[model samples]
Target: MGTGPAPGRERFLAGAAEVGLQVDVVARAAAGSLAEAASLLGISPADIVKSLVVKHKDGTFLFALIPGDRQISWPKLRALVGVNKLSLPPADVALDATGYERGTITPLGSTHPWPVYADAAITGKRISMGAGAHGYSAFVDADALTAALRAVVADISDPN
Candidate 1:
């Protein structure tokens, strides 16, 4: 399933709407970094959320929503999720787990509906994240996203 084409923009927007969120779609260039993405979206690096797929030793998967200015702290995340071993899955595994490509993965409309773990700093802020497609991003209230996804918010990141 991961080898197939990823979903389109409408799917992401529709998924957000289904959860009562109205996000603004921001155009992005392919393979852009957080800085580039923020620049393109007219926001700050801290305002960009990165949607990552992580796996546990027991095969449980999670969506780690980290801010662009920070990197996920493996130790912090392990402690938060009560797991000793956690790793970022390969691109195919990520796509299979989230139904989105590497550069365009989000938890909003995932095929597996994995649990979401967001950094606490994202609370009460506006952020940009991948929108289930390449070359596009979604801008929305981080609080709304956390509420909708029932995200476990914690300090699971460190300055990049």
Candidate 2:
């Protein structure tokens, strides 16, 4: 890592703090899969969450929190959002929307406070997710995180 301040990390930390959410950020080596990342972190894959940026049909976005062990259930999400269409925006659009690259995107410090949809599987567990920057993961109580962000909790995912 470079010997310098990481603005992405700073923004994420600040955002979490602003919402009174306590987060512990740890450096991580690049991993090819959720299982690999979980192994490296010594945690269950279910304890690792992926922060996915989902685009609404109306040129807006929402954050979808899916467990590493599962994938987004599009039909369920669409139903929950009361929409017929949703998509994973292109990387550039996602970066523009969240001020963080795809792999590091998290709602904690997004450029805009887009709505959040969290999978019910992660509720009440301690989970790890993107730290607003590459090579890092942030750990926090899932319940606290959702509460802090006022996320919509539902069964929005299926096994990967």
Candidate 3:
């Protein structure tokens, strides 16, 4: 760990710790995308879990964790969640709900406690994700991450 938490990494680490999940926070100069982040961290993109914020037609927000190499299947997600429609919330709404910017948002410590859905592929080992801020990341066991977030594991990712 550095002298201080980098950007939003601290929040996720704290949240993980509270739930008994061990986390290793890493800081980088500029990793704007999963590919870049992976390169800088010396890991594969598939090992990077991306946190996405989506809104239901009823205006409720939820979080989804997908592999960096994949994309969310909106249709499957809606059906799995039993929602009529789902789409990314507006930037302002996402920020308001998650208390972090789009790229840095994590399921941990959101302004509102929202349900979390994680891709089934994210299992069996350790994974990395944004720590509520950009240019920073945290590593935790995949199962532990899901457990900490109380996430529903599902095959909601598309092979994109």
After superposition on all CA atoms, how large is the RMSD of candidate 2?
1.7
lDDT of 1 by residue, 65-132 (tens): 99999999999999998878999999998888877888788888788878999999899998899898
As a whole number from 0 to 100, the lDDT of residue 27 in candidate 2 is 95
**What is the full ranking by lDDT, best candidate first?**
2, 1, 3
**Candidate 1 all-Cα RMSD:** 2.7
Which candidate model has the greater lDDT, 1 or 3?
1
Give the top-scoring candidate (lDDT).
2
Write candidate 2's Cα lDDT for 15-134 as tens digits: 999999999999989998889999999999999999999999999999999999999999999999999999999999999999999778999988999999999999989999999988
Candidate 3: misplaced stretches above 4 Å? 1-7
Backbone clashes for every candidate come to 0, 0, 2
TM-score of model 2 relative to the true fold? 0.96
Q: Which prediction has more favorable lDDT, 2 or 3?
A: 2
Candidate 2 residue runs with Cα over 4 Å from true position: 1-5
RMSD of every prediction: 2.7, 1.7, 2.6
lDDT of each: 0.86, 0.94, 0.84
Candidate 3: C-alpha RMSD to true structure equals 2.6
Clashing pairs in 1: none
